[model samples]
Target chain A: MDDARLAELYERYGFLVHRRCLQLVRRPEDAEDALQETFLRVKRYGPPRDGGATLAWLYTVAARCCFDLMEKRGREPVAEESQLAALEERGDGSTEDADRRALLGAALRTLDGKTRTIGVLHYLDGYTQDEVAAQTGFSRKTVGKKLKTFEDRIRQLFAGRSHEARR
Target chain B: MTAPLPPSPRGPECPPAAVLEALSAGEPTPDATRAHVQACAACGAQLEALTTGRDAFLRARPADRFLRQLERREAAAPSPWRRLFPVLAAVVPVLVLVLVLGPRLTGDGPGVTWKGEAFRVVVSRAGAEAVPLAQDSAVKEGDRLRFAYESPEAGHLLVLELDGRGGATVFHPFEGTASAPLAAGQRDFLPGSVELDDAPGTEWLFAVFSPRPLQAAPLLARLREQAGRAEPTLTCDGCRVSSLRLRKAP
Candidate 1:
């Protein structure tokens, strides 16, 4: 996309990209940083396609940017860990919902960069399987396979964590 | 003399992804595909995966307020003129002035104003009336407590009850999901009353408000060990912590 087009894309999908970033990083400033970084990368390297494909492509880029930021922060995202620990201390392990989120976050960390991006786009960002496949250059079959694999792994992780909490 | 058919798109097997998608969307899977999934371990696993992923999706929410904050950041991003064109040097002083004076004028410095009054942890018992807690209010073990709050804007709320001796427990998000949503300008309470456990002393209660959900486990563990020495009030990015003190009845 050209400069005018990039500007237009930014205006049209700014919130979309930002939303994905926030879901991953959970910090407003970090989310903003990820948003700026994603667009900057887009501006530097042209988008994968035009029209509706662009949104999927953008979602993929935003997911990667957010994960990259998470990776750069090391093991767990600092803000999320800090906040999660704060909340967890206030109770025993009976908070099943919070544990599930913690479990999901931990499970996500186990995925490779590409798989994590795909999962975030499809699951958290609510992209359709076709859209994820289109953005990631995977066949719909492969996307389906990967998503299934992700689910199994996350469930296992959640189970282990819950078991540990019970112990 | 019949036209040859193009290759079959369905082939001998159904596309596992399409079937999983349909299943996740709550649509009926093709009968043949469902039968195939039941018999094929790989397809069955895929279906299970889709189920787990959809569950996560149901729990997840877009960080709307934070996304808007990012848009604001984009709008306020440094203009190209400031970076590319030296000819606009005259605008530099004004930019500098705004940066230097804005925080001071707006009270946007490090301090975060805690809105303790916005939330109340009312305590009562089976035969008694409920009253908003005041600092040092005496309460015995088994006193039932419920939280009531008014949020200035839609946000996530986390309540932590800190035993003055250094233990903390979460109270607001009673269900224990990532965070609980509180609508702006409305008084809300936990769906049920929480009975005070055996931990008895001058306990500190903290109510944390954030514009979006937060994963706060790490901080909770840290505070559990250090809460006794920590100050009653604390602040973090996008979150404001408010406090109340209560004493266990002697």
Candidate 2:
């Protein structure tokens, strides 16, 4: 956690951390704050002891910081219209991707910290269940169950939104 | 039974974004993953996007500038004392006044005895032997420095620096808002070393040791306020402050 190592880590991964923060918070300023906070925590608690991917470890920390900031501010994750439109335009066929992308923030808020992290690693970051298990120190079964919970919650959110639209 | 969840958009053959990001950063990646990324257009495009995004982010917010912003934000964050002020005012007015105003009213209250070399600093320069720094040692910019301390009793410690530019920064447990715990007796070089910044003139390094952890933000503020003095010190009731002065040429 010395200054030299920290500076090196920041140089290497700061952008990835910032991008993760920005993805979650959707505000440049807040992302910057979370990015700093992420590094601060890294300084406080050093890096992962196990020989996992440093970038994966950083992404989890950045996501947690973003979620904490959002909760502290008592604000919903800002879903910009432009971002939604981009997702919509990039959709393969169904609006599933767009809906999943848009509802992820709200759904994530409803989850416990561990489940949320697991969900983000698996769905958002595209980590496989085994990779998520390795990073999280959870068994493959636990990862699968947590992912099921996350998917169920996402479905509930999408269902609620659909009902609202129909109404 | 509930329907199975949709598969990840990355597809079955593609590697995860984390793998791609690691590849983009030039970190070690599996040969299979690297070959897949190289052969697969989608994976290659994703890696390209990651690289492009990283470049854009670094361009927008360089490390030095971002670090400065972080320092400012840390300085500006509200301390625990500030958050408790209203409660202290309502509940214990006399105690609050004594704690708040007593030190300022009295000319620099009781000073702790310098318990026989409780703190130490070691400097390492490229192609040079590592040397332990004494009081008023000559140091140059870019000399990496490490710190150690010897304490009779276990306590919380903060190693703070007042640079030539009157800027205060935490050295040990770098960039934290509070002191880190220290074990009793002699402890050798702390975990990390800090390279001296380009700021020229006299730099003061202080090791503030206390029975309890002290908030670094308030101490940093005090150091900034007293930067004009020959030596800046902290006023903690149960805290001992050891200082090392280093002369830096402009």
Candidate 3:
């Protein structure tokens, strides 16, 4: 992609990549590395023609890079809750922060590729459930239900955290 | 980021999750989501909290500093080699003359005669060829002499001089490819080469073709006029130096 397009992506969706990676990796610095590496890869190989698919392609690349980093770390293909809580406490980045991220990361790993990918594109990346459906070849109802279920699970995760974190 | 409301037959029920979702990606919330957020203290607090984190991360690396570092990288690249034309013109004639006369290094003895049309060079054995050539080669101190050559027959004889100078001396009679060792200078020759140390000065003479009794008289006269009072210099102008003579025929 040209620098203008790359810069536009940086300005528009840069955070989703960072936050999505933070959800997977749990460390801010490592997540930053994974995101930066992902963008750099996008700069190199790049998405072709379809501007509409650009975000999804970039998201896919970022997702792959984050997974590669997690694999390299040899942790279960997901970030843990307590670690997510620490990142959230360190960040103060809203209630939708760390453990919610960890729970999402863990839920995604448990899902089949099609369902998991749809869930990530819908929730973590903020793509509409329809958009997630388009990217993952899933039906809209399937994406909608998956998202609602994911949201319920996130609520459960936070509720559990409130009890555990209560000293 | 706007919260999508619960499915409403009459209107939308904006959910905090959808609003927070939009906000997470740094986009503005949908109007319905904003109305929902305005009514909900929890959604408002979450917005305020996430925005604070976003703002802190935005300034982590200033654009000015990043651009400055890029400028430094570009500035570090070496300038395209510029061989000043005048020195080049001067070096050309001398190189041609040396190539024409077959460049007599005359050993390391007291006599090192470099014979040419306009001037004759007889060097005193007292100095190193590098020292004196560095002092006299066409380039000024710190400048380099780039030598170009094409070898003909065995034992290549290339004239070493500055660049456009090669282009210049074609006005004179010079020959040989400096691609290999001439024993005269153990170093300095590439597909091209540049003088490492100093400019070779006044001692060099660029030879020209004299056609008094032969056929090229008119050409030499025009060339001599161009040469004027200036010492013989080499040029890359297209001409064969061996065909050009320095001495006028009787």
Candidate 4:
């Protein structure tokens, strides 16, 4: 795409991509690096196949870039609770909301890489089952099944917390 | 009093997770799924939670330094034509002259004699155009010698000059010298103004067409030593040698 179109794409979705990167990388600096790389790759390879899928496509690219960066640092894919808490303390979000995100991120860590990617694409980022399957190369039936299991696990986690608080 | 929920048969509550995702993505939901989401308070609360998380994440803006770096990348990329223009400027005129005069510069014609070798050469002075050199034709120092010639056959060409003071100069194919290939019947000039220096006496010009490209620098270096000792004997394999003498005005 030309610079005008690229700039327009960046203006519209750059923050969304940066946010996704920050969520995965858990560091603002690393997230910024991931955001730059994601747009550069988009410019080089052209945008996603479907223009409507721009945000979803950007989500996938940002996640992979963050994952690769983490791997290069010889770190695990598991979210660092301390770093997330530190970033949350920066006041980008409310403490309660940050706590909820930290819990959700911990929940995501419990899933395998493929399942976690599928979860992020299907749930928080709001891609359809077919779109998630297309991006993750999973069959729609498989995505439907994994998402069911995922939702049940979250429900159980919250239910057990409720039970413990009640006791 | 609580309002009644919209009437619809919900199949397993239509997967509230998918409905929530679709809603947040601004995708159209199945009518049944929409009905269930409207009726179910638990699903509605979950959708709000997901939207809150997504929106909060999107609040992070791309830093200013990143945009500036992209602008710098665009500015650093060189335009393709800019790199090719100078090469074209130097090559086009020689091509044009070859195309315009190729048919007329036959190697056999009235020639000039020097050291028992005859070579056809057309000479003109700096303000004179296409004036053929004749007996007693003389030019002063600082006057440009506009000489044109062709080879009898296709080969590598070199024009070497020996001044009256026995200094050897390579007059073709060096830096700032532009000429054409020695294809039979292809006419070319020694590019640009080739002015005569103040060595006032007889000067010999030799044009050699060789089967292979000659290295003029080393040959000229050796010629300089011989030029100071005696009349230099120069040789090249499969070379056609021709010569002319020009009178330098005293």
Best by TM-score: 2
lDDT of 1 by residue, A12-86 (tens): 556556555655666777777888788777766877564334555776787678767777877543334554553
Please write out the lDDT profile of model 1 over residues B1-250, one tens digit for every residue.
Answer: 2121111122245443434444544545567767787877655675576566544533442234433544565578788866766755777778877655544464433534364588777888878788878777888788888887787788887887777567767777763645688789878666787788777567777777888796667446645765666355544566766778788865
Residue B246, candidate 4: C-alpha displacement in angstroms: 44
lDDT of 4 by residue, A1-167 (tens): 66666766675667557766766666667777778778777877897777465566777777777766776765433335566565432122334344334334334556777777777765455456787888778999999887766665555555555476699
| Better candidate by DockQ, 3 or 4 | 3
TM-score of each: 0.33, 0.55, 0.38, 0.37
Write model 3 residue lDDT over B71-171, tens digit each, in one string.
45446635554446667788989988766544334222221233322222222222324222322333234433233222232222323222222122221
- lDDT score for residue B96 of model 2: 72
lDDT, candidate 4, equals 0.59
Error of 2 at B15 (Å): 1.5
**lDDT by residue (tens digit), candidate 4, B1-250:** 2121111122354453434544655556678777777787756665666566555544544335455766665567577877888999999998887644442253322222123222444555557675555434666687665545565577776777777788877666543132236667666654654667899776766676665677776556656766643345454445555666667787
Largest lDDT belongs to which candidate?
2
DockQ of each: 0.02, 0.21, 0.05, 0.04
Report residue B232 deviation for candidate 1 (angstroms): 3.8
Q: What Cα-based lDDT does every candidate model obtain? A: 0.62, 0.78, 0.47, 0.59
Q: Taking the tens digit of each residue's C-alpha lDDT, what string does model 2 give over A10-124?
A: 8899987876676677666787789999988887798655677788788878878887888898875655666555441211113446555556666787799889888887766
What lDDT score is found at residue B202 in candidate 2? 92
Model 1 segments beyond 4 Å from truth? A1-167, B1-113, B175-177
